[model samples]
Target: PKDQRKFGYAIVGLGNYALHQILPAFAECRYARLTALVSGDPAKARRIGAEYGIGPGHIYSYENFDSIARDPEVDAVYILLPTALHSAMTVRAFKAGKHVLCETPMATSVGDCQLMLAASKRARKYLMLGYRCHFDPLTLKAVAMLNGGAVGARQVVTTDNSDINVPLSEVAHSWRFDRSLSGGGSLINLGLYGVNGTRYLLDEDPVQVQACILPNKNPLFSSVEDTVAWTLLYKSGAVAHGSSSYTIKDASTFRVLGDKGGLLMDPATSYWANRVSLISGDATQSWGTPQFTLPALNQFSAELDYLAECVARQQPPVRASGQEGLQDMRLITAMYESAHTGQPVNT
Candidate 1:
């Protein structure tokens, strides 16, 4: 067994995101230890608990989640539940005296995000948002280039990301389509990724926002939007135009244009490291993204790894925290408000 580590973690939910992303990511993570599994399904809990070698005591059902706060074994908890359940679960976990590694979209509303933040503080726990993309090597390199003036003055940022791959028919009857369960739809679920990235690329939160949304033809799907585009104005005179869609193939990218030259990172996806190309002067410099050979560290893995380190070392994770999620919600809430009223949102 590896030597003892700090920040032992208990993961809640055993869904696809948890199975595909968080559970497998434990190998690459440094500070976090996988201590327990929580699921509404006891069979799933026991099965995964056995597979992961978690003690039976650490296994919990949804009804008994509150009892986890008193568990002596777990130092932190990772909430991998549905996007809608994030707020209540996070707040409950925080109040239970566990350091929290909350997955993104902190919540659908700034109010809930604020409540989560308050709970974290009241519990005197570290609450970090799981935004691992910012920690990826390609993203880090892009940030360095931004700091080095490679993309000088960063005038305009144009982003287009659409995934026709995820047919609504798949999740039509699921919570993802239930407006109450999934919140606002593609604007909240998919589009928020673009919003988060905009802050990272610009190195600033958006001060203003304007946007529009559209729905593709999938009658079975809820009335929630399937696609959206928004313009965000930063305090530094930089403007970002971003879009995200699940009704199309994965066409993801973030391009920053400066007074000098622009930097491009295209074909970026949630599953893989970004494909980056820096175009300057007449020559374009490029760096290959890390293809995990042995450990296969996905973005979710990187996030937990960073969270463990941050908790042990008393440092901040690369991206925003629970409060920052509140900030994003504020901007997004304002954006939705603006879209409804045909006015510019002031964040």
Candidate 2:
């Protein structure tokens, strides 16, 4: 009651993501607090609940996730559920009168994405995607650099080379494998980064989506994709070419090419990009580079904190929103269709 504005959150699904990132990051967030938690497993919930000092009243189960709309302690819910479950829980969270910050892909389909957007509009709340890398320090500057003509009229973008080398013991239907659970395969799971990256890198919506997909021959990701290469054509006649391989050796970095110059990003800083290089002729220049910067932030924390502020201000986030997420899914949908049918996907 002391604060005039709302500033509390309840996380649904106390799984690895919630435990590893969300709750721990809450202590650093100045505007909001982790006021509640929800989980299906009683033992784990109780353990995590005790760890966070949340008592019975502040704790919830899957059966009662919707009831929290009535709980005064929670103004919003951070849904970290599997991709298939995001839409249902987000819809429920909306109906229960809570703002929802959902982890991405947003949903498996454009229809569900639009449904969530509609719910947010109807409930008069914000729906932000967990597109954490967009809020990265170096990424923020890189976006500006592209827009400011550091790389004049960006021609292409590349967001790729994720090393997805999981053991069979680590593999589980875990939602990542089931097309029903995860929407699609690696194309949707990992390729959204490239779709969204093109827009972010050049500040443009893709006019066309041309792509090809290959299976994970190693049995590690057969149900999903092992490799994807895409070309995003912009309205400005510029093209963004990207490739994503889940079996590389930590080869994740984005490069921007323009008429004037090109920029190469350090692979280490996708979430909190610190090292960036600008190349025009031969010599290179560095900007806003971090030299032994203090413990870097969890991008999700920065993302959630920004969202908490947006919720308070009745505004949208600076990065990916429900619409943006929907667009990415649309592109992904087109990619899968094209890959199966052996055609160029036009979005």
The lDDT of each candidate is 0.76, 0.77
Please give, for residues 1-347, the per-residue lDDT of candidate 2 as tens digits.
44654478898998777888788888777677888898998888888889988888888999977789789888889999889899989999999998889998899888999899999989988888888877776677777777889978787776675654454457663667766787766567766776777777888888777778765567756667767887778788888876776555566667787887788775633544346677774445544343333345668778778888897777876566888888888888887887788777677
Q: What's the lDDT of the predicted structure labeled candidate 1?
A: 0.76
Worst 10 residues of 1 by lDDT: 287-296
Model 2 scores a C-alpha lDDT of: 0.77
Poorly placed runs, candidate 2 (over 4 Å) = 1-6, 165-169, 272-274, 283-295
Per-residue CA lDDT of candidate 1, range 181-282, in tens?
667766777677778777777788878899887656767545567777889988888999988777756767888888877777776544664666666645
lDDT winner = 2
lDDT of 2 at 193: 74
Q: List pairs with backbone clashes in candidate 1.
A: 163-248, 164-247, 164-248, 164-249
